[model samples]
Target: MSSAEKGLRATGLCREFAGRDGSVRKAVDGVDLVVRPGELVSVLGPNGAGKTTTVRMLTGLLLPTSGSITVGGYDMVRQRRRAALACGFSLGGDTGLYPRLTAQQNLSFFGMMYGLRGDRLERRAARLLEEVDLADRAKDAVGSFSRGMKQRLHLARALLHDPAVLILDEPSAGLDPQSAASMRALVARLTGEGRSILLTTHDMREAEELSDRIVLMMGGRIRTESTAADLRLAAADRLGHVVNVAFADGRVPAELEHCPGILGEERDGGTVTLRVTDGAASVEWILKTFPGRTTSVSVTPPTLEEVFLDLVAAS
Candidate 1:
């Protein structure tokens, strides 16, 4: 099959769990997602937003309550065992790696499970260890590895089988800055090799930097989905460009609140906070209307955190 045909696709996948009092909680509610060949998609959500649940369903670890999913053109539920071999997944925690096994041994074991043996397995394991910068530590017991080292090993394990699709949940959850950067670069390389990846992360910077598209989930539902630029643009229009105005006379700009598109305003001492809806127009008006009274102005660009907070708060 073509790479695109071998990509991951899901439609209305839902997972409901039984709760106390016999009530059903829809942890993953009718979620639809797709990952194209050579693309990196990020699923962004707060804790308990079903991000992990979604990954589990996609990776065939958990069966969905409803809806259909296909990975490498195989039914996720019906052909689960076969589908599992066609995809690689790395989840949070240690992923149950053999503590006594050396790094190369660990990779060799997983590669063997995927039907690789002998020189081929050893070569792949050696290459992966080198790719992840752990070749020197190939013979070190996993127990002696740092958190970041373990994280890299987990990734190496995922790719040992050369699966067509990858599913990762919080891949860099507890890594240092350097490790996280390396992890991201590795992900980029995987996509460069035409592998489709679905990743869940709580890191806004990671999501913004790696994702071709971001899906934001809340309360077991998709809140919104957009590219990073589009999200930033929406946030700017909704909350407007923040301008910090310094008043020379120590009095609130008399006509500040009267400006059109001024959504909200606050004054603290001689500083004024104006939430402008039309950032450019409102800023121009401020300059013309309060030229002499305003001493300085600074604009604060909306961050991913701010956009997410406003979205959640409003919902």
Candidate 2:
């Protein structure tokens, strides 16, 4: 699809800042990213990995040193207002909302800023309050809400304009497990309604569960991009599967390492750990080879955390 037809697109995106000592720092290097209609793309990275910088550039909140951004066909730099109208972002922190204002008032204020008026603004705000499950707290001051509640309000405010694309920066950053789960459910529901989303977060499990695709960033550049399942498979292919075997007498057989599918082996106390190309096949071999000597065995596939760590280390 064409750039304009796409939900959001950025090409050669870069941002730089001058250090206190007069040296130039590239907060974001050249990075190209896209989120198609109805797709939720998660940008995963460690702290200082350019995620926030990229998001800011995409949202037109910060100017890029070089490159271009398009939101629903409008150039984010040259046609900033139109692009801004096409996208809404929930950038968590203490800055986005008026803490002293009620939730409804905040939404009304932003809605007016978006050129919404009268009945249209009120209806939209009401719908969003219910959508974010904050209908009962609509009149409560934002400063009185919990972090999770505030986040929900942030989401509601972002949706006030009913933009085609949503940018969420660590939506569940400091939320408790239950609160995080609620946020995730809200995200899932939004995407289900065919809204495109660009989510930047360090939460690996959340990315793995919610994203249609994941872009792994490191040191201001895109390290790799893939579907969650593909990334996990790649990790398993590169690092192999982990197999733990227990022995009855606390002794591991020396010849186990030489098995066909066994790539590496280590012994720790009564447990023997094996890295194998084919976990099931290797386990079968081990069971048959050791017979009555083996007491128990377990195999685990590569986790998303393991994959993310390996990719970051390599980068």
Candidate 3:
């Protein structure tokens, strides 16, 4: 099948759990998500927003209460094995790796379960270790590896079968800054290779940097789904654009004190920030009005975190 045909799709997915007093708790409500080939979509949500539940259902670990999920065009419930073969998943944490086993050994075991063996398995394991920058530590026990190293090994394990789609759950969670940057670089490479990727992350900056589209979930439902630019644009309608101007003497120009489009303004040490209706016009006006007095000026749309906060607070 073509790569596009192998993209991930979930329609009206839902999962319910039995709670105390025979109450029914819907962990995942009617959620629909799609990740096309050569694209990356990030799912962002606070704790208990059903991201994990939805991911489990999509990956065939948990069957949906009522919905359909397809990976590489294979049904997740009916043709699970086939779907699994077409999908590679890396779930964060320290659960999958065997502490005493070497990295190479770990890959070999998983490969065998995937029906790989002999020279093919060995070569695949070696290549993956190299790809994840763990080739030199191939024979070292997994327990000896760092958290970031183990996380990369998890990614290597997921790619053993060369699946067409990838699902990553907080791939960089708990990673140090340098390690997280490395992991993000690796994920970016995967996206460049034209595989469909669905990433669930709490890092708004990471999502903003990596995703082609972002889906924000709240209370087991999607609050919004769109490109990062579009999300910011949508927020601008409600909160307006944010502009920060740095002045040499920390003074607010009298010209801008009563500017028509300036809805709000605040002052800090050598800096003045404003909330204006039109970003471009406000920026242009600021530059023209301040001239030499303004040292630096920047106009930006609302950040992902700001948008997320607004959604949560409004709800």
Candidate 4:
């Protein structure tokens, strides 16, 4: 895609910090990222993996030590104001909102900063409050709002300027399951409206479910980028196949212990789970060794969590 058509792009992004021990540390190192129009791309990494640092630089909150950022065809560093207008950021937590102000007041205040005025500001604030399901509590103090409510309000504040690109830093952090689900649904809806999103989260399942593409970061650098499905498949290839078998009488089969193609086995109650290199060969040998002993069998693929763990371990 052309530069003008791209929602967000960064090249050779890097950040360095002065360590307390009198040395320079690289917080982010030579990372390149892209978010297409209407696509939701997640940066998945553990704490200190530079996810937050990358988001900060992308949103023009922190200048990169090296490299460039462009949002909606505007250079983030040189055209800071234009880049800010094209992008909105919701850094999850209670840091961005006023504790004493009502939800509507908070949105209105942010709208004014975006140069919105009079009826337009009021209308935008009202619409966003309703959009984030905070309209009913628009008059209530933000300090009294629940964590989920505050998070939703933060998202509403981000939309005040109707930005083409949205940047979220751990949007569901510290939320309960239901609240996290609600946040995910809202994010999905935003992408459906052709808004490009760049999300940073440590939750692998969240990334797997919500993102169109996953960028795995580790040790302050991008390790790999692919779809969640492809990463899981790669994990399966690396970890091998898993076969689970259960017997009717909860009895362990002694002969199956000697079965070929079984790399390892675990017995939990009546069920036997085998980690094998060749699933088909292992299953065949297992049934042959234990004839009528097996009551049910299942072969399962690796999950995204497994892939993430394996990738982290290898890195």
The candidate that achieves the highest TM-score relative to the unseen native structure:
3
Per-candidate RMSD, Å: 3.5, 3.3, 1.9, 2.4
TM-score of each: 0.86, 0.87, 0.94, 0.90
Candidate 1 off by > 4 Å: 1-4, 243-275, 286-301
- The lDDT, on a scale of 0 to 1, for candidate 1 is 0.86
Tens digits of per-residue lDDT for model 4, 1-315: 474345999999999999899999999999999898889999988778999899999999999999999998899999999989999999979677999999999988899888898999999999999998999999999999999999999999998999999999889999999999999999999999888899988778889888999999998899999999888767776787788999988987788777666678999999989877677777888778778888998876577788888888898
Whichever of 2 and 4 has more TM-score, that candidate is 4
- The collision pairs in model 4 are none
Candidate 1 residues 1-315, lDDT tens each? 655558898899999999889999999998988888888889988888888899989988899999998888888998887788889988856656888999988888888888889999999999989999999999999989988888889998998889989998888989999989989998888988888899999899998899888899988888898887788778897767777788888888567888878778889989988877776777788789888877887766577878887887887
Give the Å error, residue 198, model 3: 0.4
Candidate 1 positional error at 156, Å? 0.6
**Residue 24 CA displacement from its true place in model 3, Å:** 0.7
**Once model 2 is optimally superposed onto the true structure by TM-score, how far is the C-alpha of residue 275 displaced, in angstroms?**
4.0
Which numbered prediction scores highest in lDDT against the true structure? 3
Residue 62 accuracy (lDDT) in model 2:
97
Off by over 4 Å in 3: 1-4, 248-250, 261-266, 284-288
